[model samples]
Target: MHYDVFNGDADGILALLQLRLAEPKETALITGVKRDISLVKQVDVGQATSVTVLDVSMEKNTGALSELLANDIPVFYVDHHRTGDIPESPLLTSLVNTSPDVCTSLLVNDYLKGKHHLWAIAAAYGDNLKKVAARHCVLNGVGSQLSTQLEALGTYVNYNGYGRTTDDLHYHPADLYQKLLAYEHPENLFSNKSSLFYDLESAYEQDMNMAQTAEVLFDNNICKVVCLDDAPWSRRVSGVFGNELANQSPDKAHGVLTRNLDHSYTVSVRAPLNNKQGADEVCIRFPTGGGRAGAAGINALPEEQIETFISVLQNYYD
Candidate 1:
């Protein structure tokens, strides 16, 4: 049996989307809410013929990945995050680039020789690689109007992936991936009136409206922190809201912390747009935290350490 494992976020979903479109395959899809990144171990290697992993950090999944490689499971791994130390095995094919300007889908696009360039652009935008996405369009001769639409598609699809669990999402990531595979091109998704695009777009607007009222925990020239109440909307909008704040400020690092059920916090950190290098560093300092340099997050943070987190963010960015 072939198993396709990926992060639920746009980069992971779209990366796999491009590959499946280019090389049609029948496989079981494994995914969860955006924070659920330790997916490699969840796959039952007993019934697996091959495995494909995308967008998830290898650092966190190293143990499971090593086991799969030891068993000769034949894994194709692709990502744009901190990879601890990739195993050296003939059965393993790794395409990981930790470059701040790229996303997993962009790397997949290169692998496919641009078979799905438009979809790749959307993933780039979703990852908040806005400058790179724009430059990609300019380099490829794509017009401005189409670029804007791709941005919206990326944002909406990306917005759907955030949540405490799949229950909070408008569409499960697997369902959303299946829904999107129907469209040969990203633009076709926009043309269809009854597409998931419209639903996601509407939902994005609603959650973002709620995020506007988040309480500012701290703000300075180096970094800023905003707190959201314990609600579904808070869980659904925390990461994307961080992206929005990063884009708006560009000069200051941003953190969006949503209260969790245990009085802990779910945190999303975006390094300054002008200097996207410290997010992963800052987040990895906390337990249950890991991500790429441009944007990283803590799945759960203690309420007591909230102040410490803020101090770390400022210190890292300063």
Candidate 2:
């Protein structure tokens, strides 16, 4: 038996789809929404001859990954996360391509010899690598209008994964993947969801309006920080707010800290688009938190450190 594990977001699902479409095979799928990437540990090696892991961090899953390799089951890891020490086991084939400019789908496209280049652009768009997506679009004769649509679809689908729970999203990403896989072009997929997009755009507009009213806390001039305590709107709009703020003020680094049910807060960080340097250095201070220089997150922060965190952000600004 073979099993496929992937992040349940549009990028991960599209990467898996490209892989499957290039080479169809029977396999059990292991996936969950954006937050569930760490759940790859639950997969048992005893039940499969081979496993393909996509868009999940092997560094974070080092223990489970090492155990799987020790069991002599072949494992293939394809991802773009911050990596630690990777083992030399012959049973494991890891593709750790952590380029700030590209994404996992583009790496998979390279692996597949670019046989599905169009899909690769869609994945890149979904992952928010707009420049790369646009370059690929031009390379493949994808018109500007079509590229824009794919960009919107990709961004919206990725946004769907930011909900605090499945109930808050338009559809669970796995459910959305079913609809997505039914079409070849991302434009076609967007066509199927025109009504959904209209509704989502309106909701997004209202949400942004509310977010603009959030109190701003400047830890540093370069970094803009905001805190929302136990607000339902905060949980729903946290990620989107980060994106919107980053775009609206491209010169400043942005962070949004929202209280989770456990009283700790979740942190979303975004570096200015043009200069995404040094974001990772700040996040590595916490366990189970790391990402690209431009975008990163911390799963949880002790409530007590909230003030200290703000101070640190001020230091980053200086």
lDDT string, candidate 2, 255-282, tens digits: 8988888988888787776676656667
Over 155-242, each residue of candidate 1 has an lDDT whose tens digit, in order, gives 9888889988899988899999998898889888778888888888888899899989999999988888999998888888888899
Q: Per model, how many backbone clashes are there?
A: 0, 1
The residue pairs found clashing in candidate 1 are none
TM-scores of all predicted structures? 0.99, 0.89
Question: Model 1, residue 67: displacement in angstroms?
Answer: 1.2
Off by more than 4 A, model 1: none
Instruction: Give candidate 2's error at residue 133 in angstroms.
Output: 1.7
lDDT value for candidate 2?
0.74
